[model samples]
Target chain A: MWRCLLLLCFATSAAAGKPDPQRQRELRSLLKNDCGACHGLTRKGGLGPPLLPEALAGKSDAELLRTIQEGRPGTAMPPWKPFVDADETLWLIEELLRKQPVSMEHGG
Target chain B: MIEINKSIDKSVPLLLLLLYLLGNVCLAELRGSGDLGVVIERERGSVLIIETSKRSILARVEKLGDLSHASVVFSRDQRYAYVFGRDGGLSKIDLLQDKLVRRVVQAGNSIGGAISQDGRFIAVANYQPGGVKIFTSDTLELVADIPAVYGDDKRSRVVGLVDAPGRQFVYSLFDAGEIWLLDMRDPSRIEIQKFSDIGRQPYDALLTPDGRYYLAGLFGESGLALLDLWHPEEGVKRILPEYGKDDEKLPVYKMPHMEGWSVTGNLAFVPAVGLHQVLVIDMLQWRLVKSIPVAGQPVFVMARPDGRQIWVNFAFPDNQQVQVIDVEDLSVSRTLQPGKGVLHMEFTPRGEEVWISVRDDNQILVYDTRSFQEMARLPAVSPSGIFFTSRAAKTGL
Candidate 1:
């Protein structure tokens, strides 16, 4: 019984890692409107630092995720943990790494 | 007979050429003559001149500098638009010619601006270096600069700048929590009226349609600071003092946009900060009448020109939806999913249709107000605010 429970936990964790269309759409809107309000709508930088791939090239994925989750202290960048979860932050980082504009239709 | 026929043919060719030239000129004039509007393309640092009659984008004028939180006010003739950009670049664009007249980088960082009631001067509220700069509307030349000094050389950032009656400009100092009125009747000599301790951190403000009152939203605390422009000697007073005091405050994702509050008839639909509700206030008494629950934090509560329905849009995750509330019933008439990143909405002069900017989708969606049906979509680049020329006729836009 114990062995079976451990296997189930591992399976559920793996499934959570998979992409979710609904969550992707939510994150897309958050990144575009919330983050875009400070950073440029195109991520080219406005009141906040640029999130374009080139501007974030030197930073590692973990560093980006930490910034998105924990937020930089004493900066305009707010921790999105209240709105976004750990896995969603990871997914968001992946999408940001790809440097592709979110498609409205697909997200909807 | 042959000689006469040759002369007639020559005259006919000349007549045709003149007619063709006349037709071209007429077409050009027609293009320039119409109900004009503009959409601020935030990221691209451009403005899209739109002909509202045809529901089409006429031209996209670019290179206006940093337009992150840009705002536009039109000239008296409605032929020119002065754009105030976040990076302190003020640009004047000629609507008729669809070109930039002149642009000046006046400050390090600026929020927004206002034009004088007489259309003679334009004033910008600055964040960096903390002052308000007044410029000549036609020439874009600096006429006066009023530094927001709180005490002994302590500069405070100015916000919520608006034009009032009597060729005056009113703005709030964020750091000082004070409101100042600048009387600019004489360009060289300016009279300043300062009201201190108006609120904790006044963010943005707006003047009533009649220019009777100026309301400023406070960020550091709940409620707002109200100044009866007609009676400035009474000083500023607090309204809705207990708005967020009784409840636990939610983290505000974005400040509630006070400029877009809907004022129709006796009621004003004001967005509640950090709440998914709109506080309806009786304009006559200036008291909160009711709190209407919405989908999320309301960013803009706009009333159709007819004053029958109020349209509300949200910030961030809830920005995808726009809700229309019937004035009589005080209930949501319809909810519209206008696509992702809905930023701003503007109605036609007659209030027949509303143009909404969906920034993430990069399109401006036009919807029929009565039917609540999508009519047209014009492509744009990260569009934000939509302003109509009719606003030039209003007291405080």
Candidate 2:
């Protein structure tokens, strides 16, 4: 049931529609916990980078999608398409771009 | 009489030219091998082909979904080229016809292959499935499948495959630190011998020329383990270290499982991927002999057939080139800048040219052996392993 909802949220994000706000928050929490370990919050710069407004501000949607899906050239970032679905990637990018910075010490 | 003498002189020059033409014809025999090096781009869903000799686009076979790796084996006559895509796409290219003759879909994404001693069969290690699939070299037909007895469906990966002298072939499964010995004397039936538990991630394995023992590099252990093929039960474990294990003079150095061994079987050259040195191990003594300092992350070390020099690919972030190491003196000889993101590379059949598969720009860069100069650049993109065929050397690929 949770997997289906996650899939639905991803589908809506990819189709360029407003996803469920409650589900979006849940998805945001997941990305913050899982992806932030390496890529960091907002994709700025950590072991990877902050995936947020300032870093991804002027980039094209295609560029963001390609980098996220196919992987950036000459880095450890592998092709995420096989691991993460397209719609979920869209939601993850959205979450990355919009999330506010949290304290680095304890918790978000 | 004067007119007759002038005519005779004119006929003399003509007769000499005729003789030269006849000699040329006799010397130009039809039976000669011409190896046409082919560069294949290993990308998702599509693979591009480029003929390196003339810098021309050959073919772009598409719809092979998410092709991660490929191995090409040319027929002895060089008439046909067999391409095995890791995503399970097997294609047969007729060099003379210049088109894909047949394709068999449904092999999984794979990393390495072991061609038969007689070059009749190729056993491919499928990464996702954690198994090795065997196919007939001539027909591209599925012959056998051997699944990983120890690998997990979600986490495990297979990297390298080496054919043992007998009916058995050794496979190194990734992350598991286990080498599985598989027997393929009969394609319809297969036997499995699980041995060599060295450490995590055995990168590549190869048999010595004498075919007595097998040497595999352990990624997690930062060493190469020499195992006796004759006694799998005994399991001989010998580690070749980057620095001398007990030497107090040199600081302890541990390479991150990306080293390569030379073809001579006497030395194992470990390219310290994160360090600034190439570790040399004398295989006979099974000890670390010397550490030659290098510039960047030397990921791959490929030895030439002559066994005099070792070609090391220093794949730093965006810094694309390969380094040549003189094995005799253990020194850095020269470095050849191949081009952007040289993900994988393979040498030509005669070792005359080195073909580099640069994934970023999606092209294979060629270099001349004798001059050590960029001979030409053929546009073949996103390629992992380069392949070649000699079938129509008269009309290059």
Q: lDDT (CA) for every model shown?
A: 0.82, 0.59
Which digits, one per residue and each the tens of the lDDT, describe model 1 over residues B1-397? 9999999999998999999999998877654433899999877788999988889988889888767678898898989999998778999999988899999999877878888989999999888768899999999999998999988889888888989889988999988999999988887899999999898878778788888889888877889899998899999999989887887655556656777537888888878877888888887888988888889888888989888999999976688899998888787878999998788999998899999999879999999998888999999988899989888877767
For residues B211-252, write the lDDT of model 2, one tens digit per residue. 556777654555666677778877747575443334322111
TM-score of each: 0.82, 0.64
Best by lDDT: 1
TM-score of chain B of 1: 0.93
Winning model by DockQ? 1
lDDT of 1 by residue, A1-108 (tens): 774464445334643785578877777867866876766545655446668788888886666766887677644466788888667777777677787544222221
Docking band of candidate 2: incorrect
